[model samples]
Every structure is written in structure tokens, then in C-alpha cells.
Target: MRVRRKPNPNRNHPLHCPYCASELLFPDEETEFAWSCQDCLRVFSVQFHGQDDPPVKPEPARSSHEALANSLKRKGHEL
Candidate 1:
């Protein structure tokens, strides 16, 4: 018998266009990454990491995870 592992819970959060404030619909296409602000129509790119990269933008004081990730990436661990 085989057991299946559960996926990350956070990945379940739906992506939304920051500009239009509409739910971003992902197409059935295989792509590396994509981004677009729905409200401002600002397009951007996204890179995935285990628990880093999306540095907690607001609170600079309590950003240990972000700092650790950045440090790891700098050390060439792929963050």
C-alpha cells in the first residue's frame, strides 16, 4: 500500500488580481510563473520557495523567516 502526502495548506489560497480585485483565473497551461495586479493592472513575476521569498513586507522588525531565506539564497541554497 502507498500513502499520499497532503499538500501545503497555504497554497490553497486563491490568487487575486491586485488591480481589478477580481479572482485571477489560472488557465490549464503549464507555465513557470505569472503575476498581475487586478486593481492596478500591475504585472509581475513570482518565484516559489518552501517558506521564503515572500518576505513579510510590512513588519520589518519581525522578519526572521525572510531574513533566513535571503541568507540561505545568498549562500546558494536556492532558498
Candidate 2:
């Protein structure tokens, strides 16, 4: 079975400009998955993989090992 999507004019699809962090990148052709960032004046393409996986969750800034290494470095314990 296949699923169809209904278009909603008021629906907000979130996408930000990687360079300028602006949300004004409009599509030159949505079917072609091409987008243009007005703030950066750059054009880019969005690719969707076949897998229906969820968006990746953000990781922490430092893992336990990294935190331990930084702690040792501060105490003059060179590895």
C-alpha cells in the first residue's frame, strides 16, 4: 500500500540556511529538491534517503572519556 500526502498552505516546513542560520531558503524547484538561500545567496540540494528513519538526536558536547582527558590535562597529567 502507498500513502499520499495532502498539501497545506499554512503548514511550516522548517529548514535553515547553514551559512547564515536564516529560514528564508526558498525552493527553485521543490520536485527537484533544490533550494536557494537568500541570506547567503547560495543554492543547494536536499537529498532524502529511501529509509524512513527519524531525524538524528543531537549528542552532548563531550563524552565521559573526553571530559576525563580534559580533567587530567588541567592537573598536568600528560598522556
Candidate 3:
């Protein structure tokens, strides 16, 4: 008997051609990991190396006045 596996809903699929950067239409999967790009006519494979390090926390947004002051400082101007 053939065992059926449920499809993952959260899985992300490649949407653009890696070589030409053109939008892919119905990309063909040659194998479990290999994909074919129609525009560039290139076959490539995607693999998961490992989980990446956690993203660095972004700096808090600066107010308009603070932003202007920084811009002036860069231009060698004093507020």
C-alpha cells in the first residue's frame, strides 16, 4: 500500500527564476528538491542548510525632529 503524506500549508515555494529573476509560471519540480526555471532554462536545487541565527532587533524609529537634526549633523551643520 502507498502511504500518502499531507501537504504542508505553511511551506514557501519559489516564485521567481533564480537566474533571470523572471516570474515563474508553474515551475516544474524535476525532483523533490530540484526545480526548473522556464525563462533562463536552468535547473537548480534548493536545500535547507539549517536554521539561521535570530534576527537582530531593529532600532526604534526616530522622530521627525531627531531625523532632521541627524541629517544636519552629517552635513556639518549645527542645530
Candidate 4:
């Protein structure tokens, strides 16, 4: 009997840019938990608090422009 191994979620790569909604290509500039988007030229990171942790509530954005600005600001980029 052969035992099948479950796929690892950590091996998955992001398919799109969370900031610009652009499709990401192979060999994207990557770090341990962050990825850089070439289209928006922004760096984004995702943190998993684990299944035991409660979901986080994101801050409300007044508009798309404000959201972009806030995202960039969080990434230490000046717009």
C-alpha cells in the first residue's frame, strides 16, 4: 500500500499582486514572507497568525487612492 503525502501550503506561491491586482510571473522578487510586485513596484507581505488565532480586521480605507497610499506607506515607500 502506498501512502499519499499531503501537499504543503507553504510551497504555494502568490498568483497575483495584492496591491495592484496584477498577475505575478515566475521568479518574482521574494523574501521569507514578502513579495515584490513589478507592475506596481510595491513590496507586500502576508503574515499567518495560525488557525488558533482570530481573524484580523483591516483598517477601513476611504478610497482606492487612500488604500494605495496606506499600503505604500506601510511598506516604507514614499508616494
In the order shown, what is each candidate's alpha-carbon RMSD? 16.2, 11.3, 7.5, 18.3
Angstrom error of the Cα, residue 8, model 2: value is 14
lDDT-based ranking, best first? 2, 3, 4, 1
* Model 2 / residue 67 / CA error / Å: 43
Report the lDDT tens digits of candidate 2 across residue range 1-55: 8765555344334479767888998875444566788888887766655666569
Evaluated with TM-score, which candidate comes out highest? 3
Give the Cα-based TM-score of candidate 4 against the true structure.
0.40
Specify the poorest-scoring 10-residue window by lDDT in model 4.
24-33
Give Cα distance to truth, residue 71, candidate 1, Å: 42
For candidate 4, lDDT tens digit of each residue in 2-68? 8865644554467888777887633333655666777888877665655654488676657989889
Q: Please list all clashing residue pairs in model 4, or write none if there are none.
A: none
Candidate 1 per-residue lDDT, tens place, 1-79, comes to: 8776454343333376545667764422133344544456555444455665565566556378988988898999984
Model 4, runs deviating above 4 Å: 1-12, 25-31, 53-79
TM-score for candidate 3, please give it.
Answer: 0.43
* Error in Å for residue 2 of model 4: 37
Model 3 root-mean-square deviation: 7.5
Clashes of each: 9, 0, 0, 0
User: Clashing residue pairs, candidate 3?
Assistant: none
Selected candidate, larger TM-score, 1 vs 4? 4
Model 1, residue 3: distance off in Å is: 32
Ten-residue segment with the worst summed lDDT in candidate 3? 4-13
